[model samples]
Target: MNPLPQNMENALTGSQSSHASLRDVHSINPTQLMARIESYEGREKKGISDVRRTFCLFVTFDLLFVTLLWIIELNVNGGIENTLEKEVVQYDYYSSYFDIFLLAVFRFKVLILAYAVCRLRHWWAIALTTAVTSAFLLAKVILSKLFSQGAFGYVLPIISFILAWIETWFLDFKVLPQEAEEENRLLIVQDASERAALIPGGLSDGQFYSPPESEAV
Candidate 1:
């Protein structure tokens, strides 16, 4: 008989152990254990790429909506009013609504910045947060002077700050990588444990067969 490869031997042992475990599992609490395992596997299947893609789609749709609003604000007005009477009517209706649209645009940008901040890696969050917060603060100061409108200038920053806190506190936006790392570590540990269970031991003969150890440099 041909000698089995070390990996093949290990796999055979593991399969036997797993079959035995399944029998024991079925004898005990089969339903609850199977359900828990299925749930964990499903969550792991969702993965990081799926999450990133979903976030990207949301950001793209929001940007497109903001662009549509801008088009409506600029094109639908026909023309600026020449007469004082026409100007008053236009300002009251079109101008006021257009200002609100601009405010919406500001809000959209802030929301994007907040999203970028949240998605930053563990080490990158500090720099990303600092940059975004500073830019929002500076934009508020400059736009407040240039536009001379308090609502248009400050609304974005105020909303951004609130959203930043929510991301940090509720969503764990900053800590996702850390959580993922810990999850991967747990998986490694579990895999190692399962592999260890497959090792052969307690032979009757004086001679022993064991898995080879890797040589250290």
Candidate 2:
């Protein structure tokens, strides 16, 4: 019998071990496992990119809607009158509304950065942004009488707060868990490979049987 190449036997053994190792995959040896992880990671990140696009779209819409509400509030609070009288309308009182849109832009940017640059498995960036947004909105509601004027006051801040919280929750619950699980799988496969490398021949004495070199030809 011709001697089996060490590498070929290893691949066969890897496929066999997949059942007890990675339930969703075969090719558990280091080289193949690394290749599989690289491929899977690309697809995974592509999926995440799509999700990021969706989230960014929502955040953009929130900012625009908040801006519209602010514009409406301005007109309602004497922007039209100031224009007719040729006097500048004092917008400083409602400047917090502008901050809301700015913070929303910041929130979405940080989200992309955390994943693309930091590769973070936690929601620290989003959590911080959400905290600031929530607190600011709360203070705006409490200290200001904008609600007394119309629902625009409460609607603007409330919707912004809700959207911010939603993004934070998504990063913490959905994104982080999935990424961490995949990473853990990859690490386990790598550890198994390193351990296997340290062992002697990955075969029994009976498996070492082989024909002469000339006969194998």
Q: Each model's TM-score, in the order given?
A: 0.36, 0.58
Model 1, range 63-155, lDDT digits (tens) per residue? 455445444434434543433334245654322434333444454465445445344334344335435655655555454442343343344
Q: Tens digits of per-residue lDDT for model 2 on 8-107?
A: 6666666656534533232335577567667767766675644445555665676677667666765776685553233223334444355565666677
How does candidate 2 fare on TM-score?
0.58
Over the full model, what C-alpha lDDT does candidate 2 score relative to the true structure? 0.63
Note the Cα lDDT for every prediction shown. 0.46, 0.63
Number of the top candidate by lDDT?
Answer: 2
Alpha carbon deviation, residue 179, candidate 2 (Å): 1.2
Q: Which pairs clash in model 1?
A: none
lDDT, candidate 2, at 116: 54
Candidate that would win on TM-score: 2
